[model samples]
Target: MWARRTWTDGDHGYLAELYDRITAPTITTHEPILRKAPDLSDAWWDSLSTALDAIAAVANNRVAVRQEYLDRAMPHYLGIPIDTTVPAWTAAHGDLHWANLTAPVLTVLDWEGWGSAPAGYDAALLHSCSLLVPDTAAQIRHRFAHILGTPAGRFAELVVITELLQTTTRGDNLELEAPLRARLRFLTER
Candidate 1:
């Protein structure tokens, strides 16, 4: 079992970390990000929900996300005012993007950024990742409506979009730049 460890090289300084691998035959949420939507069963989503619940229940002393950080960083970085009022905070896979999640049998990967965040933050980020595929995005929305429809959920969505926009501006994920800009404008226009 890999109990998260950090390493620093004595040379040019870097640590290669390792994780106990999850099951095989799993396709990442974004490996072929723009590919046609995967055939998923309702059972898969149910398992995903259960896993997210379990992860949220885990206790960690580190504050991966701070209220003040969100209050300050988001607006200044995105040039969009935010609703600083946070309604709920729970353990979140902070970088909940397609590349980090696995399909068929759901298995969330990437733990480096996991931390307490706005409730439904994971769902919002995942949904945003699916924007390239409308049907998949809609399905995600339907499944997580209870969370995504709330004001706090919308705030989480904004954070997700802001991050995508910032990444785009950095010349990364250039394919998403246009769509992410539109999404950011749509969310902030109200």
Candidate 2:
């Protein structure tokens, strides 16, 4: 179930969205722990991949993977020039993280940013967020190997890594810095 409403009350304008009422709470895909995480089974990962492929199949002409934006961000964020060719575009969740997903039944929330993005973007974003959990990160890479194995997918992973590293410099997710930096170095190294 999805509903979006735009309203103006007095001088304030608001846009509110009602996603599905999930039975289970959001998965722990964010910084700072609160409680035990839900059991993420292989079947759940399969569902995620299936849903992602379906979503990517949808038609969208939007330029979500903005080359100008990526090129401009790379130098400032990762301090490296992105000389690789930009990959072809496909639909993506834009902000795919563990917190946006629900367990038991797969439900991806926060669709406001969904649009055309680089291939393997959602997978890379998920992998980027799972850096703290090495096992989960490895599972994601394995599940989406076909996409992540491609040249465009590697570039997408690098882009996500750069973004994650940039976020860490701001003092957020400090624990992930070491792992992210190591992965960045591994990718950038000849």
Candidate 3:
């Protein structure tokens, strides 16, 4: 970010940060959701995974996704008393979707929600957003299998699914409702 500013008017206050322009285009279309697999190189994939790993290593107190939210949301959305306790916690991008990523060269955009979350929360979020594109979703799962295959990983995925499903009630990501439910059922049955 090049500049940041804050201003207040009466009881209202606003904050903004200006960033340098990025030349690389986002991996997917304008929407944050991925509808198809992008034709990015293996190196790009490696870079993305590495970047996520690095981000997770950072220490922070900010809470992007809360345990209370997870505990409340899981049973409501999955109709099961699923455990919401994360095996591990780490920093995450919080909104790691296709549109927030750039191809050719990896560049992560949007840090507004960066904070601590479940260990594999970022990977789970990226995978969840890629569900409409099976190939991409599979690639995400494969790339992050080390994280996504563990109990912590599964719980992270559950958290992502629950959040998405809850948003559907407000008419957001409505197209993902069925897929999210399907994933939810599969996870619960495991």
Candidates' C-alpha lDDT: 0.73, 0.78, 0.89
Q: Native-vs-model 1 lDDT?
A: 0.73
- Give each model a TM-score: 0.81, 0.85, 0.93
> Which structure among the candidates has the greatest TM-score?
3
Across residues 136-186, which tens digit of lDDT does each residue of candidate 3 receive?
889888989999999989989998998898889999999998988888888
Sort every candidate by lDDT, greatest first.
3, 2, 1
Candidate 2: clashing pairs of residues: none
Better of 1 and 2 by lDDT: 2
Give the worst 10-residue stretch by lDDT in candidate 2.
29-38
| Alpha-carbon lDDT of model 3 | 0.89
The per-residue C-alpha lDDT of model 3 at residue 45 equals 88
Give the alpha carbon lDDT tens digit for every residue of 1-190 in model 2.
9898999999999898887567776786564222343478878888999999998998987655577777777777776776745676789888888788888778898777888877889898888777777777787788899988888788888777767777778987777778777877877784
Candidates 2 and 3 compared by lDDT, better number: 3
Candidate 1: clashing pairs of residues: 30-98
Clash counts for the predictions, in order: 1, 0, 0
- Kindly report which residue stretches of model 2 are placed more than 4 angstroms away from their true locations once superposed: 1-12, 29-38
In terms of lDDT, the poorest run of 10 residues in model 3 is 28-37
